[model samples]
Target: MDTHDLRLLANRIRRRDLQAVYEAGAGHIGGEMSVTDLLTALYFHTMKVDPAAPLDPNRDRLILSKGHTALALYVVLSEKGFLPKEEIATFLQHNSRLNGHPNRVKVPGVETNTGPLGHGLPVGVGMAKAAKLDGADWRTFVITGDGEMQEGSNWEAIMAAAHFGLDNLTLIIDHNRLQQGARLEDTNNLAPLPPKLAAFGWTVLEIDGHDMDQITAALSADNIASGKPTCIVAHTNKGHGISFMSDNVAWHHKVPNEAQYKQAMQELENAQ
Candidate 1:
């Protein structure tokens, strides 16, 4: 799909995500909205995966490191045909496989069970290293929130990725600048992330996270360094696509009221 189509898909995903969060009465909606574009570009345009062969050995791997936004991932998976769209209504329900965090065993497209911050990159590094050792062509991609970047484990994984020359690995940081209860700057500022990742010996690309063209270009493997991992610092708003919620920290896990829900849906529809 082209960038225009991708944007439309992303808007649709955002609408569905809003509905899911409102229906479930709980979700990391802010982060989900922030990261929806990245997820859409990956599943719809960048990644090489067959929904019918979910376990295909050569398929590209995507680990949603900031897994609280699993609702967004689930919506993308459903749109990509990994699961039935109707199953989305069961989100956060008792006995539903579509839990708050993604589980690899229960979800077809989920590569690893991720919820605890800072685990996905290490696992992605391992996956990339394995592919390298086996001379495989498949790649591994991991998306983590800016708040999650404070985890020392992610830096360790970053260092290790460089040391191992795992160019097949790509890490996209959703730099929404907000966490659960406060702005990332107010909690633990990790600004100017590009220099830090570049100092660690990775190729860094910074771009407006919501721009589908920029997102698709950044994700392309054409100009990647041969022996260095790539990090795309995707600068994004916390609650993207909605008028009142954009960049609002309070929306992190807040359930939208009926009026708020209607407004959010209208905004997304207008964007479409």
Candidate 2:
């Protein structure tokens, strides 16, 4: 898709995500807004998979390692035709398939169950390695929170992905600089993230996480430098697009009050 179309789709997804989060009475709306553009750029512009044939062996894969942001993924999947957009209203409801974290077994497009930090990259590495072992041309992409990087498991996965030469893997860090409790810098800082990934034998690309064109280009197959895994550090704003909440630590998981909800919904609609 062209940049204009991508932007429009992203805005629409953001609006839907906002509505879903509001109506469901709970969701990680802040992170969902932050990652909407990146997810839109991937599912609509970069990834190769038929919504009707979600499990097609040759299809490219996406793992939202920041699984609390599953609502964002669900909105994208709905837009991509994997599920009814209306289903999003059931988010976090008891027994609802649209849980706070994505479950691959229960959801069509989700590749794995993810919510805990530091788990996505390892699973993505396994998927990429499996593709290489099978001589398949498919690629695997994963997006994780910046704070999630503090998990030792991600480093372990990073070492394995590099050592195994799983060049088909692309890891995107949602470097929004804020975690639920505080700013990344105030918490366990993972700042100098690019240099760290580069030192691990990965090709590093930095881009505005909210820019569709840049996100598409960075995720394109040609962007992967051979013999190395690819890491795209996506600089983003937590609670992006919502005026009162953008980058506000309180919004991390804070439920929006009635007035705040209305304002947030209006802000999202205005973005369209």
Candidate 3:
């Protein structure tokens, strides 16, 4: 898909995500909305994986480290035909495989079970190292929330990635600025993330997270350095497409009431 189609697909995923959250009565909707574009660009535009053969050893791997926003990935996976689309409606329901966070065992496309904040990047490092050991060309991609970056585990993995020269690894930080209860700046500001990662010997690329063209280009294989991992600081807005919710801290985990849901859905509809 070109940039135009990718945007359209992203909007559709947002609509589906909003509906799922509203129906489920709970989700990390703010983060989900913020990360939709990144997830879309990866599954649709960048990664090489066949839905029918999701576990193919040669296929690229993706880890949504900011696992609270698993609904967004679940929607994208459904759109990618990794699972039945209707199963999304069962999100957060009793015994639904589509839990709040991804389950690698239950979900076809999910590479790992992620929900704890700081686990994804380190695990991603392991996957990338395995590929290196096997002399495989496949890449590993990990997306983590900005707030989640405060975890010491991520920084440890960052150093390890650079130490091992894992060039095939790309860590995308969803720099949305908001966390569960307040702004990340107010809570534990890790602003200026790029320089810190660069200081650790990783090549860092910064871009507007919502822009599909920038996203796809940044994720391109050409951008990876020969002996250093890549880190993309994707500046994004929480609740990105909805007027009332965009960048609002309150929406971090709040469900939209009927009126809010309608308005949000309308905005997403017009967004396409």
Candidate 4:
């Protein structure tokens, strides 16, 4: 899809995500909203995957490292035909397969079970390295929150990825600048992320995360460095697209009340 269509789709995804969070009475809605555009660009325009064959050996893998926003990933997976759309209503409900965190074993499109802050990148590195060893053309992509970067494990994975020359691996940081309870700057800031990644021997690209064109361009395989892992510092707002909630840390997991939900839905509709 082109950038315009991708934007519309992202808005729809945001609407659905809002409804799901309100219905479930709990979710990382702020982060979900912030990452929707990146997710939409990947599943729709960037990744090479077949919903009919979710486990295709050569399919590009996406690991949502910041799995607290699994609702957004689930919505994208459903839109991509990995699961039935009706299943979205089961989110966080009793005995639902769609839990708060993604489970690769149960969710067709999910590559790894991720929830604990910093595990996805390491797993992605392994996947990319395996593909390299097998001479496979598939790639591995991981998205982590800015706060999640504080985890030392992600830095270790970065070092390993550079050492192994896993150019096929891409790490996209959702640099929204807010965590669950506070701004990232107030809690262990990791600003100037581009320089840090560049110093680690990775090709880093910084862009407005919500811009569909920029997102698609950054994710294109043609931009991959020959022998260096790629890192995309996607600058974003915490509660993107929704008025009143944008960049507000309190919305991290706050359930929208009836009035708030309606307003959020209307804002999304107006954007459409």
lDDT of 3 at 209: 100
lDDT (C-alpha, whole model) for all candidates? 0.96, 0.90, 0.96, 0.95
Candidate 4's C-alpha runs over 4 A off are: none
TM-score of each: 0.99, 0.98, 0.99, 0.99
Off by over 4 Å in 2: none
lDDT of 1 at 266: 90
- Residue-level lDDT tens digits of model 3 in 1-272: 89999999999999999999999999989999999999999999999999999989999999999998999999999999998999999999999998988999999999999998899999999999999999999999999999999999999999999999999999999999999898999999999899999999999999999999999999999998899999999999999999999999999989999999999999999878
What value of lDDT does candidate 3 attain over all alpha carbons? 0.96
Better model by lDDT, 2 or 3?
Answer: 3
- Give the per-residue lDDT of model 1 (tens digit) for 1-272: 99999999999999999999999999999999999999999999999999999999999999999999999999999999999999999999999999999999999999999999999999999999999999999989999999999999999999999999999999999999999888888899999899999999999999999999999999999948999999999999988999899999999989999999999999899888
lDDT for each residue of candidate 2 in 30-109, tens digit (9 for 90 to 100)? 88888999999988888898999998999999999999999999989999999998888888888899988999999999
Pairs with steric clashes in candidate 1: none
Worst 10 residues of 1 by lDDT: 177-186
Report lDDT (Cα) of residue 114, candidate 3: 94
